[model samples]
Every structure is written in structure tokens, then in C-alpha cells.
Target: MSDSTDLPRFPQESSPGPTGPTGPTGPTGAAPTRPGTVNGAFWAFLAATVISIVSGLLVLGERDSLADAVRRSDAKLTAQQIDQAATVAMVAAVVIAVLIALLYLLFAVKLRAGRNWARIVLTVLTALQVLSLLAGSGGSWIGYLSCLAAVIGVVLSFLPESSAYFAAARPVRR
Candidate 1:
């Protein structure tokens, strides 16, 4: 038998096996590179989240005006009843806005990681926002801005490169 040092050393014994750091496939198999389009979509979705928060705060700022409007619209409501109605509406608005922002953040992160399901969910949400605006929901300019960003994000998610990246990552990704 040969001496220990005379035998093939660790580095010479093997380069990289199937379980190497680069993985079984090859180099770049560890993680698919995120395309520019997917990255852009991520940023757009993040911007939409920020816009939604700001819009929610602005709506909250108009709480007094909302109460006045409700008071004017219904002549039969007592002062306490009007206040309660305004409070309920405000709470509903806050809940809806928070839910929307949370969804955007969750899906945006997954989309950046090349999740096709996230892309689809984000697309559906964008459609809903557009439809809401078109249905005369009395959206403010800020709402329109948020919708525009979401639309851009969804569109980017469907680009050819983005689609390919998502597809490739699905097989190797967990």
C-alpha cells in the first residue's frame, strides 16, 4: 500500500460530485438568476404597497369630513349614530387596505423568487383594481397611481424572460 501522502489527496480524489455546492445539474443550478423584468415587477409591486398605505392614511385623515357627509346624507341619524357609522366605515377601510398591502408584499416576495403562482395571483389583483376604477368606485388620483403601478407589475411578470425564469425555477426550486 502507498503512503497516505502518496495517495490522491482530497482535492485530487474528486472535483465536485453530484452533491457538490453547485448541485447535481451544473454551475448556476443552485438558483436561477432573476430576470430584469421580474425584478422590475417586484419593485413595482413594492411601490404599489407604499402607495396603498399612503392612500389609506389620507382617507383616515378625512374622517371628520366622512362623518359630516354621512350626517348630511341621512337626516334621521342621531349624533351618536352618525359617529358610530363613521367609525365603522373607517375601520372597514383600514382593514381592506391592510389586507391588500399584505397580499402585495407576500406575492411580490414570491414573485421575486420566481413563483409562478405568485405571478398569477398578482395578475388577478391587478385586474380587480383596474375593474374597480372602471366601475366608478370614486377612486382618488392616488388610487389611480397605485393601480398603474400594479398594472405595470403584472405586465412585467408576464414578459417572455420572466415567464421563462419562472418556469425554469419551478423544477429546481423548492
Candidate 2:
């Protein structure tokens, strides 16, 4: 007889074959409510990034007018300083937005695919986001909302169905 290792790998070889009648097939659709906490976190971060980008672009577009206004004022700030400061702020905003977006995207993929380490990262990120809401400017209602969304996402992603989906999607370790 051939060795077991030489045999073709098959489910039937390891388990009993179907003997009972099959159940009716249900309509195919996406699994509802998989741990989308990761998705939520990603979206929240994305929104924040977009907001920063748009705000930055707006500031950049109005830089000249703002500088003019400042120069017209009694403050009499130098045009060079005004231009330099605006440029610096615009560049910083763009860089920060890009970095946050990239990081969120990476976490989103991991959470979507159910990587174990992703769960820890997501949790930490969520907590930090929530803390930022409290620590940041009180007038930033948007930041508060975004932080709330992240918290919700993390909670949803940790649900049983979500966890199972992630586990199944994760790579099978040899």
C-alpha cells in the first residue's frame, strides 16, 4: 500500500462523507457585520486626512490674500515672514495628512484581512484617538466625532462574527 504521505490530500479522507439530505441554499450575499471596526477606524482617519488636506489647500489658496490683510493691518508684519509662515503651515499640513492616511490605510488592510497583530494595533490606535479628542481643542467637534467613530469601529470589529471572519481570512500558519 502507498504511504499516507503519498496519498492525495482530501477532506473525505479526514472526515466522514455527507450522508444526510442537504439544506436549501440561501441567497448569496456579503456577510453582514463582520468586524468592520477596522473599516470604521480607516474611514475616520480618512475623513480626518481629507479635512486636513482641504483645510490646508484652502489656506494655501488664500495665503496671498491673508498676507495682504495682515500687511494692511497695524501689526505691519513683514510680507516675507507672512509668505514663509503660510508656506510652512501648508507643507506641514500636507505632510501630516499624507502620513495619517498612509498609516490608516495599512491598519485598514490588516483589520480587513484579520491579522492578529492588527487587532492590537487597532485597539491602541482607537484609544489614542479617543484620548486625542479630549486633549485637542474643545471647539473641534469634528475631531470628537471622528474619535467616537474609531471607538465604535474597534468595538464592532471585535465581535464574534468579525473575529471569526478575520481568523478565517488570516493566513494558515504551516
Candidate 3:
């Protein structure tokens, strides 16, 4: 026996008949087709990503307001300090947003490929994103639109048909 493996081997022609406890071994099941709901979810996630990028760009126009808010939150800071803080905050925000958007895109592709874990992770991310959007905005139309798309995506991803399709897709491990 090769040192690489010592497991028992079964003859290919020795499949048991239906009299076996697990029934006769037969041909493997084919992969499940991608469902409409998953496609809808994928599109919704893409829409949310686009809306978020637009919203971030629009937010750049409000730098003055951001600085004022930062000053208010810390009265002792000098004007230069306030500006630096605001700039740092904005840069950090953009970086984090970009990372989150990329994550959404990655999971969306994986979910479309019938990865069940991707669906679950995407669902949680969507919930957090929607909650953050709501908590951070008063009535920003862009934020609302993104939230709507994210909610729709998560909803579609968990629907019965999507769930069944995801469940039906099983990965083979080496």
C-alpha cells in the first residue's frame, strides 16, 4: 500500500442492490440550477453597492458640516485639530465603506455560485448595513435607497425557493 493512504477500497462493480439499508448506489445527482430569487438578490446587492458609492461621493460636498460637527463634539480642539480629525474620519469612512462594498460583491458572487455560507454571511451583513444606515441618517434619500436594496436582497435570499436551491447545492471536498 502507498504510504499516502491506507483506507479500504471498494470495487466499482460491487454496488449493493436495493436490499442494502441505504438503497442501491446510483448515479450522482446533478447540480441545481440557479434560482430567480438568488439572481434578484444578486442584482439588489449590486444596486446597493452602487448607491453606497454615489452616496459617499455626495457626502464629500458636506465636509464643512462634518468639520462643524466634529468641532461641536470636542470643543477644546483647535481649528487645525478639528479639520485634521474630520479629514481622518472621512478618509477612514471611505476606506471602510470600500471594504464593505467589496465584501458585498464577493459574497454576492459566491452566493450566486450556490455557496450556502455566503448566503448566511450576506444576510448578516445586510442587516447590519441597514441598521447602520438608519441609525446614521435622519432622512437621507440615498441612504434610504441603499437600505431598501439591501433589505430586498436579504429578503429574496432567504425566500423558500432560494433556500431550497442553496440547500440543494452541495460541494464536493477533496
lDDT of 2 by residue, 62-131 (tens): 6677566656663666768777766776677667766876776677666665576876786797787677
State candidate 3's TM-score.
0.75
The TM-score of predicted model 2 comes to 0.59
* Model 1: residues with Cα > 4 Å off, grouped in runs: 1-29
lDDT winner between 1 and 3, please give it.
1
TM-score of each: 0.81, 0.59, 0.75
RMSD of each: 6.1, 7.6, 6.8
* Weakest ten-residue segment in model 3 by summed lDDT: 17-26
Q: In model 2, which regions exceed 4 Å deviation? A: 1-12, 15-77, 170-174
Give every collision pair in model 3: none
Better of 1 and 3 by TM-score: 1
- What does the lDDT read for residue 12 in candidate 2? 50
Residues 34-143 of candidate 1 have per-residue lDDT tens digits of 78999999999999999998998787788899999999999999999999999899989988889989989999999999789999999998999999999999999999
Model 1: per-residue Cα lDDT at residue 29: 54
How much is the lDDT of residue 83 in candidate 1? 90
The alpha-carbon root-mean-square deviation between model 3 and the true structure, to one decimal in Å, is: 6.8
Error of 2 at 108 (Å): 0.5
